[model samples]
Target: MKVAVVGGGPAGYVAAIRAAQLGAKVTLVEEGELGGECTNWACIPSKTLLRAVEVYKEAAEYLQDLPKFDWKAVQSRRWAVVKRLREGIEKLLSMNEVEVVKARAQPAPGRAVKADGRVIEADALILATGSVPAPLPNLPFGGKVLDTKSALLLEEPPSSVLIVGGGAAGAELATLFAKVGSKVVLVEVVDRLLPALDADIGRTVERELRAMGVEVYTSSTVLSVDDRGRAVSARLKTAKGEIDLEADYVVVAAGRRPNPGPFADLVKTDERGHVVVDGQMRASAGWVYAAGDVAGPPYFAHKAYAQAKIAAEAALGRKAYYEPLAVPAVVFSDPEVASVGMTEDEARRAGYDAKSARVPLSISGMGLISGGAGFVKLVYDGNSGRILGVHAVGRRVSEIAGEAALLVEFGATVEDLALVMHPHPTISELLVEAAELAVGKPTHIAKRGP
Candidate 1:
């Protein structure tokens, strides 16, 4: 069988490689960067900048004299990292014997992809065109109004920025600029930052952002923006009523919609233009599969990677499916926030008798030594004692999210987690201690009264 994967991103490249491994002739097509948005623009570049900001923040207090940060050098380093990783993807595709074509691919007549004025016929086709930023009405990408792509390519940090979304992307960028001495105002239409996480987790992140000097205005919307050359002026509607604000740039991190590209009419997409796939990652047609941001919500690179494998295997006549009970999300803020599985409200809405417990990270020896302030929250089924969800916020809590994901995925009970015996003087111990608190064991701190 021959397989053709369009959009050489995390999903497309991985799908191409997987199909090649399954004894199929694979052709991969990409118009721009082979590593897609994650490597070229979004994930890699943003994280590299954020990491530098984190280092400066960690040392700012301890050192009396700190050298000024170099924006050009940071930009150079970010591009360098992107270039190396993109080359690595290219090498992997070559090793797998997948034909790599650099061109914009369009759907051709009958199971074929047309790219660079040539058609590649295949028995199966996988669409992974990924996504583009959702544009705000009246506030398009130009002048001082920027999308995520343009925001990262800024020559130097802005004197002031008004970020018009409080999602993970906006929050991370807000934290980055505030630490780098830019006055930042983060506005979210929703009631909290990181709206997808548990409420308390979002509140904790808001606190951390304020600590870093970011002025956060939740339940706020940017009604309009005017670029006056010298500065951008924006009218915002908040709980306190409408107000006018000015900044060097207004960033719209509101959200992203699936690119779909040339495959829009070929497959079924949701109202928001995301491909609607079955449990096996198959779209409207059996021979046509979709993955990554083009596939749907969550829109995570790791989720795209997993879906790529599933789509490839399913196309190869294998019994593979993308059935995940828990997906972990991490925000690389000063104090990282991570969450997996259901929130307490979600569990209850799903008809589970859920009960939750919280253990402060400050109580742990590692937390005390590190001087970090955050907490671990565990949501479990009160009736069956099964773990429902795990949410955490603190330094390096992103790493702990993996274990939380596993417990939620496996349906581990509070008693099971409490008995596992986590190592002493570690961040992970908070998970066990939270579990103990849930099962009435009380190992780390005094048991809370019912």
Candidate 2:
């Protein structure tokens, strides 16, 4: 089979490589860097910067008079990390014998794509064009008004920044700037940070951000923004009332719109412009498949990878499907937040007899020693005792996501989790602790009164 993949991003490149591995002749096309925005601008770069801050904060707790942080060195290191990863992706594509083309591409009527004035014929086409930042009205990206991508490229951290939106991107940016000595005022139209996750997770993150001196205004919207030469002035409609603020930059991390490119006309798209795909990652058009940001929400690269592999295999006459019981999400804020499967409310809404238990990280020996303040929450079927979801917020909690996902995926019961002897003096024990509490076998913490 001849496969032509559009957009050399996480979804596109992975689809191309997988298709090639399955003995298909593949050609990957991209106008920008191989790893796409996640590699060059969004995930990799932001996390690299955040990791530096994380290390510094960890060291400052014990060490005195640490060397001053060099913004230039940090920026250099971020780019170096991006470059190395981008090269690795390129090497992988080469090793798999997938042909790569650098140019703008458009889908044609047949199972073909037109790129740089050449028509590339293929048996299947995968669209993974990703997405572009959604700029707020009257606050177009320019000058002192920045999008997430432009915000990362600033020569130096602004003295002050007013960030709009409190999703994963907004929350992480607030953490980055606040830690780096920038006065950050984060405004979110939603009721809390990370509104998509469990409510308690957002509450925990908000507390941590406040401790870092970040002014958070949930249920707020930017009414207007006026960019002055040296700074930007903005008016906000907050929960309290209207408030005006000025800052060196106004970052619109509000959201992102799918960039399906020319394929939107060729395929069925959601009201939000995301390409609609089925369990097999198959679009309405039998010959076309879409993955990644262009496919829809929970816009994590790992989700894209799963969808891409399914699309590639299904396109190549395989019976692969993209059914997953749980997809974990993580926010790299201070005291990282990670959640998998249903929240308690979601479980109940779906008609499960849901009961939940939450235990503070302080209950764990490692958590106490690490001084991380957060909680592990477990949502389970009260009747059957099956674990439905696991949500956690604290230092190194991101590492617990895999175990949480597996338990939910396998329909493991609270007893199943509590019975397994987890390693001692580890943050992961918090899960076991929460499970024990749910099963009426409390350990490390006193049981609540009935």
Candidate 3:
């Protein structure tokens, strides 16, 4: 059977490769260059901008420990990296034996896709078409009223920026602006920064941002933005009533929506405009599968890849299905954040009697090695001893996301992880220690002898 994988991104390309691996004639279509929003705009570009910020922060804050870092040269080289990576993805799709079509994909049911006035019919269709930056209705994004995408594209950093959201994207960019020497003040409508993150993790990051001189406001709203090409004046709602905040730029990192309206009449998208898909990434409309950011949240690239693999299998008349145990998330902020599985709230909602343990990384061996400051939190069921959730916050501690995710994925207990030997003085030791601590049999802790 022939398959047409629409939207050439992590999802589309992975699906194409998977379909080809399954011995199918696969053709992939994308409106832009390969890698979709990830390479072109979202994940990849955001990281490019933050790399500059990370280096700059490391030089000043971690100078003695991190070694000599060329701040100026490193930041300047991002464009070259982005340019090279973008080209590499294009080349990868070409080498995959999947015919690549660069044209806007018009989604149609029953394994049909239209592109730039040409119709491609296949036995199966994979709609990996990605997402767009969420619209700000009253406060529209323009030249000065920027979104995360535009914020990354600036040749020179602004003097100051007022970020309008305190989620992962907003918080990361706020850190970026601060590192690049922008006087930044992040405003969130919620009670805390990164409401999506666990309160403890969010608090840790919030404290770090405050220590870095980035002003954060909880329970605040930007009423409207007055854009004047070079600056934006915002009327905001705060505890002390209305106040005006001025900045060189305003970033709307509040949210994102599926890039589906173009293919609206063709697929079954939910009320909120996200493409609805079953376990195998199959759309309600037959033979049309959806994956990636367009599919839903916990919107990590890895999740999309997994979904794409299953979508490819299902498209080929294989009886494969997707049963993801854990979908991990890592935020690329200064003292990064990572999580997997359910939140405590999620477990409670699902009617599980849950318990969680929070550990500050200041006590870990790896934390001492990296001269650490942050935490590792493990949330699990009290009765079952099965891991339900895990959250981490620390400087470079986010790299251990894989190990943390593994424990959640396998339902590994604290004692189970304690038996596994971890490399001495590495960040992974923290995960081992955190899990051991969970079973009330912590190796490193002072145990009361029987």
Candidate 4:
């Protein structure tokens, strides 16, 4: 099979490599750097910077007279990380014998793509053009108004920043700036931060952000912005009332929109312009496939990787599908938040007799020693005792999400989780503890009457 993959992102590159591994001749077309936004801008860069803040805050607890943060050095290191990863992708593509073309590609008729005035014929086409930052109303990206990509490129952290939207990016940025001593005012149109996750997760994150001196205004929207060259003044309609704020920069982290390029007209797209794909990651046009942010939400690189693998295999006449029982969502904020499967509300809405148990991280020996706060919540089918979801927020909780995902994926029960032995003095024990509570075998916390 001859495969042509568009946009060398997490989705495209992975699809190309997989297709090549399946004995297909593949050509990957990308206008920008390989690894796409996740590698160059959003995920990798942001996490790199956030890790810097994490280290500083961890050291501050025990050290005295810390040196001032060097933004330039951090920026250099962030780029270095990006560069190294990009080279790794390049080498992978080369070793796999996947041809890479550095040019903008357009889907041509008859399972072909046109790039740089050349038509590349293929038996299957994979679209993974990724997405761009969604612009906020009355606050276009320019000058002091920044998007997530541009915000990371700033030479120095602003003395004050007003961030719009309280999703993963907004919350993480708020954490990054506030922890580094920048006054951050975060505004989310929704009622809570990370509105897509469990309500408690948002509440925990909001509490932590407030502790970091980040002014959070949920159920709010920025009405207008008046950029005055040096700074920007924004009028916001918050839950309390209308308020005005000034900041060195106004960052619009509202969300992202699919960058499907010329393929939108060729394939089925949802109302949000995301290319609609089926279980096999096949577009309405059976020969074409779409993955990553361009395909839909829960826009994580890992999700892209899974979908890309399915798309490549299915496209190459293999029996693969993009069916997953649980896909993990993680936010790298202070006291990181991670969740898998449905929330309690979602489980009930899905027609399950859902019940949940919550156990604070403080109950764990490691959590107490590590100064961790927040709780681990397990939403399960009350009748069957099968674990439906796991949501957690705490220091290093991100590591637990993999196990949480597996529990939901394999339909493990609360009893199963409780029976499994977790290493002693580890934060991961919170899951076992929560499971024990759910099964009426409470440990490390006071038992409640049924």
Q: What tens digits encode model 4's per-residue C-alpha lDDT throughout 355-389?
A: 99999988888888766689999999999999999
- Identify the superior model by TM-score, candidate 1 or candidate 4: 4
User: Against the correct fold, how does model 2 do in TM-score?
Assistant: 0.98
The digit string of per-residue lDDT tens for model 2 on 1-450 reads 899999999999999999999999999999989999899999999999999988888798899999877788999999999999999999999999999999999976577899988999998999999999999777788888899999999899989999988999999999999998999999998889999999999999999999999999998889888888998888999989999989999988989999998878999999999999999899999999988999998799989998999999999999999889999999998889989999999999999999998999998889987665999999999999999999999988988999999999999999999999999889899998999999888988899888
Residue pairs in candidate 2 whose N, alpha carbon or C atoms collide under 3 angstroms: none
> How large an RMSD does model 2 have?
1.1
Q: What's every prediction's RMSD, in angstroms?
A: 1.2, 1.1, 2.7, 1.0
Q: Estimate each model's TM-score.
A: 0.98, 0.98, 0.93, 0.98
lDDT of 3 by residue, 93-209 (tens): 667778988887775545577877878888887888777788578767777888788887777778899988899899899888787678999999898988987888888888888
Badly placed stretches (over 4 Å) of model 3 are: 61-76, 107-111, 369-371, 445-450
Which digits, one per residue and each the tens of the lDDT, describe model 1 over residues 1-450?
999999998999999999999999999999998999999999999999998877776787689788898888989999999999999999999999999999999989998989999999999999999999998887888999999889999999999999989999998899889988999999998899999889998899899899878999999888889899989999999999999989999999989989997689998888988889998889997799998999988889989999999999998899998999999998887678889999999999999998998998899998876657899999999999999999999887888988999999999999999899888889999999998899888876997677
Cα-based lDDT for every prediction: 0.91, 0.93, 0.80, 0.93
